[model samples]
Target chain A: MTERPDQSPLTSPRSERVRKAAALTGRSARRKQGRFRVEGPQAVRSLLTHRADLALEVFLTVRARADHPELASLAAEAGAPLREVDEQILRAMVRDSGDGGGDQGGADASPGAAVGGALVSPQGAIALATFSAEDPAAALGAVRALPADGPVTVVVLHEVRDPGNVGTMIRTADAAGADLVLLTRTSADPYSPKAVRASVGSLFHLPVLTGAEIDALLPALAAADVTAAATSGYADSDLFDTALPARLAWILGNEAHGLDEATLAAAPLTVRIPLAGHAESLNVHTAATVCLFETLRRRRLEA
Target chain B: MTERPDQSPLTSPRSERVRKAAALTGRSARRKQGRFRVEGPQAVRSLLTHRADLALEVFLTVRARADHPELASLAAEAGAPLREVDEQILRAMVRDSGDGGGDQGGADASPGAAVGGALVSPQGAIALATFSAEDPAAALGAVRALPADGPVTVVVLHEVRDPGNVGTMIRTADAAGADLVLLTRTSADPYSPKAVRASVGSLFHLPVLTGAEIDALLPALAAADVTAAATSGYADSDLFDTALPARLAWILGNEAHGLDEATLAAAPLTVRIPLAGHAESLNVHTAATVCLFETLRRRRLEA
Candidate 1:
């Protein structure tokens, strides 16, 4: 974990390498480079811990390096190059990632700066990693092949537009022991900096397959013998009362217009999380957390 | 609901009133003016529906006015002024609010702006309203006075620094039929633009008391006969197995650091939301949703 004795720290924010790293913040740039940027100590730690193989490089401020001594060894063990930079360079790279530096009201324009409100709180560590591009069909098939003795749970995001919601749901899905997370074609790119930051490295913990179609996915679930259920505010089926199958796919929809009529109708069952207060609906991510936790709770009870 | 044909629409974005409205985005300006700005159709709709008396003025673009005709009548009925403006003017006001304009990748710098990356998706409608500055003690007393036969639920945010999380928890608490939502002194301002927007009008739907001290709050809950439960990942008590009381408060801590030792020690109960997957901990807001909903579910089950 010790710093290399021979090399000087990367100092220039405008260096070609720095600019290239900053470019990964964009979707097309990430697509072309075949990698995404992950920021903050927690996320970087998760990267080094779970998906070290995908880590291309790791960058840290002197302060961050001191704060997290083990990250260096983790990076070294993964064969990912570890570079130490000044705080300015780290901030420059994070700022350029387009993760919401603009909204820190003038007063918070400094220390209180919560980039993107709260989702992107950069804590002086960043990494670039390649997320494997998995074919949705093959991904579903792989999960289906898991031993039949254990339950197979999947969460399908259908055209969800918000990256934070998408990422938060991914984290929740991961926490709930879901086997895989699949996003439809129109959903937010899980590789987006906001989504990755929000995921807090869970993006590395599970297989996240994007660019899927519900049309193909529903049939795939059927073939895999996984029951599919859509979440809707208007649905009559209550989540608590419904007995879920051993292999289940929980389908969540867009933030604004929920699941389209066809998608909702296509699902074998529709369930609503009962709202006891005045809120018209739960945030998509919050609802997903409840649903995932409920599934876990039920499964544990049954066991 | 008809727009006054006699009066011309407010057209200048640089006008004093527009600038003053923009200033409310700052904490000091909001405190000084005794008002906070609420943006978008959903929040504005909630303001008009629930706290109409607190609304001073409503601003809408031509399209917004046309899209929501009921707002005009609602504002008029409340004796609040409604002013029409152009989309440029509305955008200018929103942009100046300092809600995450900088992080939108250059391409999304326009339509895809996602000001503050989804937390602040400013639509054309905006409202200036007064949130009653209730003393934390008085607010707790009021909730404690609610019918004794019915369960009283309260959510306490202890030094939670994220505005979006603060707002989202408030919304979830409201949705879970919580009697009150309280925040400690170091917590994010619930009136912050990002928080208000993330709350999606639930701030108007419920009473949100800020600047509370956990020291006083814990004792207050004890006096009020409401059980206080601090959420901790390390706690031995599983949230699912614990039987809650008729009146309860779910205490949540900061995002990076969980509850402090003093606060944790003072709470009557410490409960952990079981994580079935690899996520180290739930986002503070996500955890609150699980806690609040679980409470609601159990109460309903008992009924």
Candidate 2:
């Protein structure tokens, strides 16, 4: 992962390496090159700390280096090359990063504009990580081998399209102490820049296996002895009143069209977050957070 | 406020009224005209239903009127003139709408791009409404007049800059049965296009008063006999363990800078949501939802 350290900072946004890094914003380039970019200091810091083995390179403006002095040593310890670049390079890197195919950004779209305005200013740091796509079968096998001392919670996103929502759910799942996140193939790419930015580095916190099929995942959960729980607006059981299983997989549906009827019927439990007011439903991220935290709260009370 | 009925559909994106409607996307124009634009069907529907008195005009494409037949009667009942428009006009209105001063949108920025990708395809409907600014004092007085309810919950956002976050908080506050949401002067405008879109029409479901000062609001809350509780990352009291007051105000801080020391010290109560995982903190909306719902959960249990 180490590159030849040239003392002079990389200043050109049009440089070959910068262009290649920027291209990773699109899905095809990331898929073809087997690497994805993590923007912002928080995400880069997490990459250097947790998944250093996957860290390919770390780029930062001189000011960012001054702001966070420890990043240099962190990158050194992680065996990833640390390069200094100007703000323009950082801006150019995030500028054209598509919104994970939601809307096409204009050719002249400003820096960080492609991320749904999730990030306004450059955090002055970005890093590249080799995409190690986790297989659901292998991930489930890992979860199955865990000790049975307490309940294990898995968050499954089924065909959720928004990268920001996907990233936020990953962060919230981690915050709720969930074990793993499994995403069906139609779900947003967790490794996208928008997702990584929104995750605030939680993508590296736990095993997030994408490319799942609900049909295959349901049987896989059964094999692992994990109970499947789906959230539906019309569900009979209220989330607050229902007693969730010890080993649970909480399935969330798409943003526009929720879980299909067959999948909803297949789940062992379907619960709704009771709305006390006139809102038709909660945002997907909010619902997921409420659901995951409720599970955590229950476990805490049980303890 | 009704425009003359015209049988011909609005075809030009460059018409005078269209330009004026598009200008409401900016703060100065909205302030000058005393009107804000609400985009998408959900928000427009809520506006016509709850605050129809404020509805100035409704614009819809030919397909939108057909798709949502009820909108015509709703507009008729509201006495707001409904005008048919083309997709281009709908697109034109949303395009170049600034991102509430967060960042400048380019001249060629696509439709709905200004909203942080909150809305992708136009919902084929948009409405202009008189900006009715709610007074915090009067709103608090209304809350005071309510019967000794189970619990009166008010969500306060202090200098939070994100329009989407503000909108989501409003929606979540309504969902949790909160009485009102007050925003400090430095916070994003709840009537902004991004906010109205993100609120999913919940803005019409409850009273949201902006332009508050913490110093004044603290005294007002106290005088109203509402306990002001501020959420802090370092607070000692866990949200679950704390016994809240019958009348409560949940004060949330800015995304980057949290509640200032003075504000935190002045609050009657301070509590933290116990994060079970490694996240530094929950997203503002997620935190607000958890805090508000916990209050509701406690009240439900008591009932």
Candidate 3:
């Protein structure tokens, strides 16, 4: 295990690095700087476990580092510089990282609401990480380059604005062994703190392309011999009855509105997860998970 | 078709019914008053469609009723008195309902964040409904009375504290066609505005018993001949390989610590949803959905 270097606590709430990290909550800032912040212990741990080299800076409160040795150890192993900060600074960082949660500078940052302003920071670790701008064209090229011997699944989310749902979809896509998670321009930013928290650390597991134009991406995937299937409640084919191809992409739409006409028109087919009972519709996350796992189940059955 | 009567908007945020509706957010109030609120248009519609007789009061904002003539129509169909209130009253009702997303009372209550506080209410319709205290003994008795010829699945939530997760479970239970959704005393209040919003409309679709003592509930379920299976990541039997009973109760544990030793030990068998990916575990809601759908898949295969 690599030893963490000693560092003085950075007491300033307006430090440059902290500001930069906080800026990551906004998609514009992330795209502009090619950097994003992963908050809380789970997401930071995921960064260390899956893609540690991308981690540039790790910040923890003195108490957090003392209580969560794994945070310091992982940061050390990832070779990222770790700094102990006053808890107020961390809250400022979380507050600056907007996710609808207002900032409370008061000392009563209850232990229950731990991690400064960590959107969901029960574990109290946050990281500043770098990223290569995800090129939809490049992602399309990679998906097309697969060896073609087994099932290849990709998930496309169009106009899905909920960060938590987007994050959960990424995690489900990862668990279902997806090749990529593509988002249309209208979708929520995959790197948003609320989404990163909801993804349970699966954000770093695979390629997640944000801001792809649906019309262009669908055609590109189709050209690459991937069949596009949109999950819909009113679709003609039941998911179980649909003949999912070896190379496929599952397209999901906005939480409130299903896929728009243009996006729906782009899909080759639509598969509806059968609901025996009455729920006018499934949550976007639930529908995505069921669709992904259903494919997984089918592949296993065929095997 | 019953016509909605013309009435003045209930403008005062401090009105008696508004405060009572707000009080329904607290468990003590719900238990003492024998009533609870179901917010948003979808839940209100479901209440009218399924158990209209239990509806005590229907409250809607002037704009909500004007825009959604269906809200008034449904309440009238349910034979419940519909009162048009000021939007401020609705906001106050939503603000008083706590899920820790502090009240930002400005009027951007987009239809998507359904219950003004649900963070996902897309509609502004809210209703007050009556519920009988769920007797675990009677609920178990009812499950035992079901005809044994078809699959009857029940969901048992043990100490799952998050109201959102609890509500999602109820909705999934409805979609999965589960006969019952029972919660241990340690679980979050199922009727809390947050949970009710998450359940979508399923809170009214089926029986959701709160304050169930798992140690007693499981044996009683066992005695009723409904096999009790606890969901665990470490269980010996893979869910796919396990023998599911015709009448089954799926027990899920707390979001963080998981099932207590006593609950796990009492379960006739523990079945784990197999995860082939690197994510440490599924979200409690996700796990519950997967298990129920897997059961659905298995039954479909057998049929």
Best of the candidates, DockQ: 2
lDDT per residue, candidate 2, B1-303, as tens digits?
A: 334434565778887767777776666667777888888787889999998988988988889999998888999999988988788888888765444333222321345553432346568998888865646565555546645645688898997877778888899999898988888878877887767877899999987787777787888778778899988878899888899898899999877678889999999899988887777888777788888888888878877
Clashing pairs in 3: B111-B121, B111-B122, B112-B120, B112-B121, B112-B122, B113-B120, B113-B121, B114-B120, B114-B121, B114-B122
lDDT winner, 1 or 3: 1
- Those runs of model 3 whose alpha carbons end farther than 4 Å from true positions after fitting are A1-9, A14-16, A28-33, A61-74, A86-88, A97-119, B1-9, B61-73, B97-124
DockQ (0 to 1) for model 2: 0.47
Stretches of candidate 2 above 4 Å error?
A: A1-11, A97-109, A114-119, A134-136, A146-149, B1-11, B97-109, B114-119, B134-150
In candidate 2, the residue pairs with backbone N, CA or C atoms under 3 Å apart (3 or more residues apart, or in different chains) clash, namely none
> What C-alpha lDDT does candidate 3 achieve relative to the native structure?
0.72
lDDT of 3 by residue, A1-303 (tens): 122333655667787756665655566667676777787777888998899988877888778888778988888899998877777778667655334322111111222221111224434577877776656666566666765666778898888876667888888888777878888766777776666766888888887777677767887888778888887777889887778887889999887688888777778988878886787778877888788888777777777
Q: Report the lDDT tens digits of candidate 3 across residue range B132-203.
A: 675667656666666666778889998887777788889988888888888877777777666777788998
Full candidate order by lDDT, most accurate first: 2, 1, 3
For residue A134, give model 1's deviation from the true position in Å.
Answer: 6.0
Q: Against the unseen true structure, what C-alpha lDDT does each candidate score? A: 0.76, 0.78, 0.72
Q: For model 1, how does the per-residue alpha-carbon lDDT over B57-148 read when each residue is reduced to its tens digit?
A: 88888788888898899889888888887777776665454433332212112331343344344577988888655366665665466556
Give every candidate's TM-score on chain A: 0.88, 0.90, 0.84
Q: Which one wins on TM-score? A: 2
lDDT of 2 at A119: 41
In order, the candidates keep a fraction of the true contacts of 0.52, 0.41, 0.33
Q: What is the TM-score of chain A in candidate 1?
A: 0.88
